[model samples]
Target: MKNILVTGAAGFIGSNLVLELFKEGPYHIIGIDNMNDYYDVSIKEWRLEEIEKNIKKNKWTFIKGNIADKTLIEKIFEEYKPSIVVNLAAQAGVRYSITNPDAYIESNIIGFNNILEACRHSYDDGNNGVEHLIYASSSSVYGSNKKVPYSTDDKVDNPISLYAATKKSNELMAHAYSKLYNIPSTGLRFFTVYGPAGRPDMAYFGFTNKLIKGETIEIFNYGNCKRDFTYIDDIVDGIIRVIKKAPEKKIGGDGLPIPPYALYNIGNSKPENLLDFVSILQEELIRAEVLPSDYDFEAHKKLVPMQAGDVPITYADTSALERDFGFKPSTDLRTGLRKFAEWYKEFYIDGKR
Candidate 1:
């Protein structure tokens, strides 16, 4: 069985990916996270509980700690000797980064550096160690670009938020390490990932919470913003495909670096308007009994100007993802949101109480 170390395994995407990985076969998993109260520790803990319930034999090990802890990360690498490492643990949220810039610097930047260093030194035993290193990048990197579908080849030099800056920095760091140490790494620029057990700070979940509480929900950019909302299952599938196939070395004439390293945008090609997305979500919530059937969504939604570090739109050009993996996120908004509503009712409404 392959040994895989997945950081942020208790997170929405990470937890879902762990469940999927377990289904593939018996594989030893070293899951690490700080379990910070950034959102709700109970939600993260509940996800772990669900994983444990399924894999009763304990094919997974959980380590509660921060990724920025260099000694801890290095020790885990030395002991587990993980062949594949997926770094998804980072200080998430674009708006939060504005007030808590220190968090981003410490977790995203410093923590990422630690992960790279550990991966580099893992080969000290004179073995072909760490065949692949996959980490999370965000669509926020293409901040305020006038382009319709943001392509991976587009110049992403301008980042409007600290979160975007940190993500872009991760790409640059990975490139330098890949060039210097010949460690095959891939960075996935996920586009607005959402679905069952999604982050509460995200628009969909936040809006749902306010709508249920009979509170006015703020609609940024006067509800004109668009987003390429990708589903969790699709993101996990794309990760799995890319993990198995690392990038090929580009020769001198190609204008690309030598060695196996690549970056791809995993997203739904279709960009939906913010207003339409909320409407669909409202419908799903009402259908799932999370909200009253007669709930007045129009009265509860308040249109407002864009907030600081907010982008107008985000659309992904998944041509590279399709050309290479022959797969793309195809789940429609209604379908994905329906699953999310069901999960919210079961977990928060029924199970938690």
Candidate 2:
């Protein structure tokens, strides 16, 4: 059985991906996460528990550690010798980066470098190691570009936020390592991912929490922002498809490797207005009986100017993804939010009762 290593395995995307992978077949899966208090440790723990329940003994292993720890990462690589390394671990937040830039550097930069170095060393002793390395990148790297439906072919040199800069750095570093070591790698530029058990810091999850407490939820950019909100399942599906196929390593005219690197923008092509998104979410919440039928959503909403590090819109031109993978995110907002609202009720409301 080929070993697969997934970092940040307790996170929203990480956890979901792990769970879905188990369904694919019997393969040894190793997951590691720091379980930090960035949002709520309880949610991470809950995700871990869910993964544990479906895990077959000896087929799965979980480790509690930070990817920023160089020694720890090297130790894992040496011990597991993973055939596929999916580095999903990173400090994820836009506004949080403003307050804590150190976290971004520590995890996004240093930690990723550690992973790359490990992959580079995997073939030191003529070993067929690390067939593919897939890591998470963000659409935030696009910054406040005037382009609609952001494409991978566009030049992304200017980054508005430190968080975006770090993500862009990850891509550059990965490209260099891929060229130098001929390591097959693919970077996924994910747009706004949302679903049940997602991060509490996300707009949908945060709005739900505040509405339950009768607190006003702030709508940024006066609800003028548009986001390509990709559902968790769709994102996971795209990843699984990519995992089965590694970027082909080829020889250049100069007798050198052609990097064997690839990047793709994975998201729902349709972008939804923030106001429209909120309305659908509220409708789903009420439909799920999480809120009352007569709830005053208007009174509980406060439209505000754009915050720093936030983009006005994020639309994905997923033509490349469809052309390559024959798949694009198709989950509509109502369907996705419905699942989230029901899960929220069961997790927070019904469980507490």
Candidate 3:
């Protein structure tokens, strides 16, 4: 069984991926996360618990550290010698990046450079190093494109936010590393991912929390937005399929190994209107008993102008993902929200496992 290293393992996508892999594993899964209080550290802690419940104690290793620490990352590579490296550790949140640009640089830029360096060195002295490197990019790199369905072929030279810029930079950095070291790498540009046990800072979760507290939920862009809200399960499914399939390696005419690099958008091709999404989330919230049946959802919803660094729509052209992986994220918004509502009720209201 291959030893796999997954950074940001306590994170939403990372934890879910780890849990799913553990279910079918004899592999040693090494997970690393700083456990920073980006939102509520408790949610991350709870995710760790969820991961623990699914794995044999000996099969999983959870390390508490930051990827920006080069020495520590090198030590992890040396000790574990992970064959597959998935770098998901990043200072996420577009708006937050405006205020905390340093965080983005530290985690997304410096941290990712370290991962690339580690992967490059893993094959030192003819040692069998990393077989494949998978990392997370974001749809924000599209940067409010007028295009209907965002395509990988679309030029992403314009990014509206620091967060988007950093993600774009990651792709460029990965490509350079791949070219220089022939590291087989795949970068996934994830759409708006939502579901149970998701980040509390995300819209769906925040809206639920606000309604529970009788606070107004802001609907940016005056409810004129559309988003391809891919569910957690769907996202994880795509990652699993991509993880096992590395891009084919090739050699140049000069006998130099060409970088095996690829990029794909992991998203539901279906884009749902913002207001319609809120309605479904509200319905699910009531159905799950997180809100009273008589709750005034309209009163609690505040439609406002779009915020800075916000986009009007995000529609993914997942044709590439489908053609390559034979998989597409098809979970409907209502169905996905229902699951999130149920899980929210269980974890937050009922405190049931």
Better of 1 and 2 by TM-score: 2
| TM-scores, all models, native as reference | 0.96, 0.98, 0.98
**lDDT tens digits by residue: candidate 1, 178-295:** 9877789999999999998889999999998888789999999999999889999999999988878977655556665586789999999888999999989999999999998999
Q: What ranges in model 2 sit over 4 Å off?
A: 56-58
Model 3, clash count?
0
Candidate 2 lDDT, 252-275, residue by residue in tens: 999999999999999998999999
lDDT at position 19, candidate 1? 87
Candidate 3 weakest lDDT stretch, 10 residues: 50-59
Clashing pairs counted in every model = 0, 0, 0
The residue ranges of model 1 lying beyond 4 angstroms of the native Cα positions read 56-58, 249-257
Alpha-carbon deviation at 297 in model 1, angstroms: 1.4
Clash count in backbone of candidate 1: 0
Model 1: worst 10 consecutive residues (lDDT sum): 248-257
